[model samples]
Target chain A: MMDKIIRDNYQRETKIIDAVYPRTYRDSTIVHSDRLQCVYDVFTYTGDRLNDEGVKMNLMFLHGSGMNRFIWDYYVAHLLDYKLGAAINKIVTLDQVTHGDSSVLNRGKLGVGYDWSDGARDACKVAQKEFYSGLEDNSDDIINIVVGHSMGGFQAMCCGVLLPSLFDFIVTIEPVAYSPNVPNNSNVTVLPPKFFKAIASKVEDEFKNEAEYDKFMHERSFFTKTHPEIFERFKETERINMEDGSIRTKMERRQEMLCYMTLHPTSYWLLDGAKHIKVPVVSLVGGIATWAPKENQQVLQKSIPNYTVDVVPQGDHLMNIEMPDEMLKRLSVHFTKFAKEYQSKNYDNSNKSVARREEIFEEIYKETERNRVKNGKPVLAKL
Target chain B: MMDKIIRDNYQRETKIIDAVYPRTYRDSTIVHSDRLQCVYDVFTYTGDRLNDEGVKMNLMFLHGSGMNRFIWDYYVAHLLDYKLGAAINKIVTLDQVTHGDSSVLNRGKLGVGYDWSDGARDACKVAQKEFYSGLEDNSDDIINIVVGHSMGGFQAMCCGVLLPSLFDFIVTIEPVAYSPNVPNNSNVTVLPPKFFKAIASKVEDEFKNEAEYDKFMHERSFFTKTHPEIFERFKETERINMEDGSIRTKMERRQEMLCYMTLHPTSYWLLDGAKHIKVPVVSLVGGIATWAPKENQQVLQKSIPNYTVDVVPQGDHLMNIEMPDEMLKRLSVHFTKFAKEYQSKNYDNSNKSVARREEIFEEIYKETERNRVKNGKPVLAKL
Candidate 1:
């Protein structure tokens, strides 16, 4: 049934947006020249959509590091199955800056040391533009949910904290929400910045062809268990062709290394920012810990009062990629349950949600006004 | 001559400032309650002071972690010698937040994960209030020089970047301006967060009396070569006399650990922020590498075009604490050379410096006005 849905109607519109956020150092030194060009794909439901009374969801999917928006194509196709399709509105998945098409746009401007919060802000900007643009509120009717994997999972968590009123529910698959305070697995020695550089420097950048790249990836343990079709999808989405008929990874190795260095600050932010998250979050951890330890996962569960931890017995850090079927099953069950519960539950803050939306919109309008005034541009309205 | 000056003429007045800057996480989540209470001592020249024709100067001293402003007392006392005292007007030594008196004042409000940039800002606020407050510019007459050790040294470099027109020169003693891109000592494995926490947790926080601390510190290699008088000063400034007759360190173990975790970001910031620093910076590194590798020190020299590195033989990371005489000698020579050069050399941007000062003041005023408006206070000025 899922295959038929994907084959028949998996149409998507690609979005290219100029994200005006300037890159900044840890000391808040804003680099105005470094801008992120965000690229996302919106998969709108072509079939009969849900009515006004039914639960309508604008699902935002964020891919992990070294991945692009197209990674979610297979998963989005599965979401379109009749079991979850009735409530589907649109599925939006984005390529993080320095990944996929966005990397091509931000090539020379990419700065050293990526901050996960910036990634969160990037995601929020796109989400706000897509779902909450106007002054009129649409909170009680349409729900916005974020589904992310690995690094993206952590960004999803950040989204919940940055704008508490934006997201309805968050699903994180093996998120890197580690805290140094917690006791981690003894066997796994965390990589230092030096090691990160070494690893990135050693990565093979150029390949002869797609077939050659496939052969190389097949040898790696992480890719061995990945679904063959998904592996093919990765080859398509994760690499770009050169003029000389060679191919290279869309995400630069330097950018990937910066992402690794960013893991430290991300852990710190997660520990401190966890207390501010008011939305319900469901984290899927693997039985065998890979990057974030099992103990850290437990701490993460305890950190957020509304967070739940679900351990997949045979899965590891790359569970979503390696065991897509298992992840899809869990996701389907969760969506169905959440959708049903969401519709029946008495939300006392339904009115507050509308008011909060207006407040957010007003805040955005005021900021725009400030920028307009700063640039000496003509102002449309007074703040 | 140094001994005569120390015994007869050294006098200092202590000042406590309420640093209005709030504690913020890497994600920019500002914790307003966690404010820094800065404590500094202003040492006035009781002897014949330098006139406006001569080089009038304000030298600011900053100590390292597990230390206080008093660590510079011995060094400050020496600076009043006839060789350097003729040109010296005043010396100000400050205790960083979470150290000495400042730590006692900030006991309950210290947040986890310290950012070195905040430390720099704290120093800047104090320097600005003490030296650069009035609308009239004093850039030409009273040259501001910052002398910092270890963590404080890095913050000194940061001050140069934050307000380019504030300081004329910076002297850093074994600053932790490390970069992962540089080749570091292979023997030193960068301590992971778990190790930092473990180390902090294992630190001796309580002692029976001053004698016990002396005995404990005497056995440590870093303190073995420290002057006995300075060692006594350490006991006086580094620990707090508790109500229960027990002595505890002023800087909390948790805060110390946060300081360690911050080294990573400090390294990243120094690498990025070095280029923006227009002032001449002299970094006095130890011959034996301690926390930061010699290679990283060299990289620091390379990163800042005007930066110079001087290695002190027989000195380690605690060179300033262990061998104050050597550091003082270098400082005196540099100050004498700079003072003479500054008087003769024509600065074409003397007018620009005044303009820059006004620009900074206006920025501060606008920010304060915005905050006042946010808090519903009466507006005092226009942008």
Candidate 2:
């Protein structure tokens, strides 16, 4: 009955995202433009497709870790049916490589190992082909907007910063930054890495069928608190039949562990990206999320130029899911204004504005450090 | 029959450590040298009491978070029976101020909501009275050594660093440092802070008797892996029957959460202490603990003048519990050597030795940074 309810929601065709990018595993030679296929769903506006205006605006949504493009399917349906009437031309959602129906070229060699940089490069490849390549002489007239959550958020920010000309407008929600300045409420205890390896070991590679998998999932809550329908949609979208005549998850456990261990360390990449990015950013924060909240955004915004924030009041870390209406309401205003100004060629995409914003962020950091001293709080150490 | 089996081991009196120290708490005025009592168990040496050479080496064991001094009781029993063999004079194990039978001076205000710095201060106060003040003016002749695990390990490092005059020798096992430079492999996912609060709220503060609590605990694992007798000893020593009607855990749940939150953020205090500390430090690593291992110790030692490490093979983060014999074996060698040298007045306690050690540490950091750059690994951000 549950599977029927979920399957009924996603009856549309799932398109594969074909792209090739360079990849490297630990202690091995790097592979350049290695073939990769990710899956995505695109939503076109009801009436805006044939709009008389020459300027265009489209959104590309990126999902976080342990989740696929199915996360945005609910938002797309809700947005089209009720929100954003005819404000946008198109909306694109893609599963990250190794997630959902995604596959890589060197199957065995690239098994379950990929870095955040790889994810960023892959997203860039997909965006370049789908959004930019076929553009006519009016390339500057288009705004390839990007929205991402968690891991995707980190990757999206990287895309916006690293390849500035590719992605125009960016919105990153609760991007993970492990810097000391970021207020993380996660467990600080040294739980053994083997504990996760053990958890992975416990997962059986083969299940009799979807029914057995469903029954097993019914006994356990995936996350602490989440809507039942969302989890059901996940199982519907991500679970698949294996070639060995059994049902199993699309992504492997060993790969997930590798992803965590390899990329979990914090150094200076995110901050470096933020330091040089030419565009403005809107960082969304879950109001009550102590783990990764507005405070972390404040740290990012202080360092990054023109990085503003929107907080969903009373929302948890799953802000996009828990408070979709609030998220859309906050985002639509910015989208409408951006589209209107860009359409009229009135928006300034100049270096002067970027310079001014940099000064503003500098001043903010200085003020924060001053007040921290005045209030007897410890001043955050910078790199 | 089960109770008989459990209680058969810990059949000694649990002594209360009485001392007075200044304290401040939430929503209360500062109080000076407030009288407090901490629980402890002292184990004297075998056969050899007074050494022929008139040398002395005393041991004080400090337990980790959510644990009483009963942890060292196992080591003491094992060491006295076999390992130490009268090389040391006395071994005393004390509960941290907010744990075990310790009574806070400001009872209502400090109900388990103290910071790590407070833990350090309280520990110093206990050491001053119990170890130092009890002795005659031969302070330089006698070695006041301390061994601690987890939070206690951190505090022991702090004691060795901050109050270098008091604490002569220190062995810190798996100390927690939340700095960016300190590589930690714990989960970086944002879990709700309320989860711990909710867990605390569910705790039945008042239990009918020891049997009920014992039955309750039987369902849970104390540490990752521990000997049955050690856990059983914890129940006997830390669990107590309250006068009015019920039995309860010595440490409150709220206190545990506060300790985690207030002290979790990274700062310059430990680094500042490390820069100017006078005593030698030995940091023990569970060879397999990726969370905070030798790499992190290298960072700490770079700033500290005299810091070395001992790695326990095939051990987890809980070094004291998992490899008690190895921990003691490594420590006993150092203790015996230090005692003999001190007796002969031949141990190097010169400024030149400290200076030379600092240079060695500086070279290690430089070499590590050079190798990191050479291998294309990101250099860890310095505070």
| Backbone clashes in model 1, listed as residue pairs | none
Cα RMSD (Å) between model 2 and the true structure?
Answer: 27.1
Runs off by more than 4 Å, candidate 2 = A1-20, A24-35, A42-54, A81-87, A104-107, A111-113, A133-139, A179-212, A215-229, A242-246, A264-267, A293-295, A341-383, B1-383
Score every model by TM-score: 0.46, 0.41
Evaluated on chain B only, candidate 1 has a TM-score of 0.80
DockQ value of candidate 2 = 0.01
Highest-DockQ candidate: 1
Q: Which residue pairs in candidate 2 have backbone atoms (N, alpha carbon, C) closer than 3 angstroms, thus clashing? A: B21-B33, B22-B33, B112-B255
lDDT of 1 by residue, B186-222 (tens): 2111443344444554455577986776666676424
Provide the lDDT at A304 for model 1.
78
List candidate 1 segments past 4 Å from native.
A1-7, A26-32, A49-53, A133-139, A179-203, A346-383, B1-383
